[model samples]
Target chain A: MPYIKIDVTREGVTREQKQKLIAGVTDLITEVLDKDPKLTHVVIQEIELDDWGYAGEQVSVLREKGITAKKQ
Target chain B: MPYIKIDVTREGVTREQKQKLIAGVTDLITEVLDKDPKLTHVVIQEIELDDWGYAGEQVSVLREKGITAKKQ
Candidate 1:
């Protein structure tokens, strides 16, 4: 069995979006690995900003300092 | 940055157990890949029995049929 897990920063995730991800990821795994969909598993996790850290600081902290927050 | 994800069939998971998993996995990744824990991300997903299938049947169905139900 091929198990696939996807993790994303939780900010603005909607139910419909997650549903689409589940479907798309399943299909991609099946195509790439030639694995049976019946035996494949796909899981998605939405993580809080504070729990995720980058550059030695949590994302929440980085956003507060305006280090990586902006508009183009 | 290294991202680690773990997926398991949800049965009787407890909060304390998941915390241990997060810590242990982070340590393992750091030791193996030489990545900083600050930049390492670990996510755990507990899946429902219905959503996970094996041997061409859902785990719930197998349990119902008394195929893999146990006392061993």
Candidate 2:
């Protein structure tokens, strides 16, 4: 089983959306990686923009540069 | 179910060690967080020193500074 952690901005996403994302990603992983769905484990971390920094740059900085990063 | 993902260096750790760590962490989470062990889902990510970077610095850099950061 592959464990997947998803970090996302939870501001605008609905609870249903979050659930859907988890289910969809789990399904994709099972299909693409040939793993069992029952063995799948997915973790979701909803953090504000400031919580996750990359390459010494805040996510806002990347957004300002027009570089969009998907959270998953 | 609460999903927990562990990111650790796997170089010197044995498979048994990894499994032990997962079980220990899961136990700790359950005890401290009052979560259910049966519902607990843990994922372990073993990444090379280069794949993960933080604060514009590599893990090696942090190790050099002697400010050891624990991976989870």
Candidate 3:
């Protein structure tokens, strides 16, 4: 019953990357939390820039102003 | 900060429904957990049937066998 939710910006993430993330997170939880992989659920959510907020401003607007995740 | 994630099958959820879910969940957390609505983040994830697993089988395969969520 280990449920993990990963939220990332919709920034052209590949299917392969998503698969790796799911597998890696599942393994990490199994090792650290002593959870069963079969009972673990890893959900990835790709949030739109406009929908994601930071410091009371939309990420889309921040990106337009040249403030990216890497800069932050 | 309070982060809430809601996962459901990718079954034609509308924008209005998503908005209602976000608002309702924020309000619920504020009331029950005493969390500030401004610090709350509600994410809605729509998962494909092929990606979701149940009873050691993918939901798509289970659906083909007529094992729906309602039945379980």
TM-score of chain A of each: 0.80, 0.65, 0.90
**Which scores higher on lDDT, 2 or 3?**
3
Interface-residue RMSD per candidate?
A: 4.8, 13.0, 4.3
Q: Give the C-alpha miss distance for residue A4 in model 2, angstroms.
A: 0.4
Best-first order by lDDT: 3, 1, 2
Interface RMSD for candidate number 3? 4.3
DockQ of each: 0.13, 0.03, 0.12
User: How well is each residue in A1-72 modelled by candidate 3, as lDDT tens digits?
Assistant: 977767789988766666667767877887888887778876666789999999999999999998878854
Q: Give one digit per residue, the lDDT tens place, for model 2 in B1-72.
A: 688877764346688987898899889989899998988888887754332333323344446687565665
TM-score of each: 0.51, 0.40, 0.57
Clashing pairs in 2: B7-B72
A16-42 per-residue lDDT for model 2 (tens digits): 555566667777876788887656655
Where does model 2 exceed 4 Å of error?
A: A54-72, B1-72
Error of 3 at B55 (Å): 11
Model 3, residue pairs in steric clash: none
Q: For each candidate, how many residue pairs have backbone atoms clashing (under 3 Å)?
A: 0, 1, 0
Please state the CAPRI-style docking class of candidate 1. incorrect
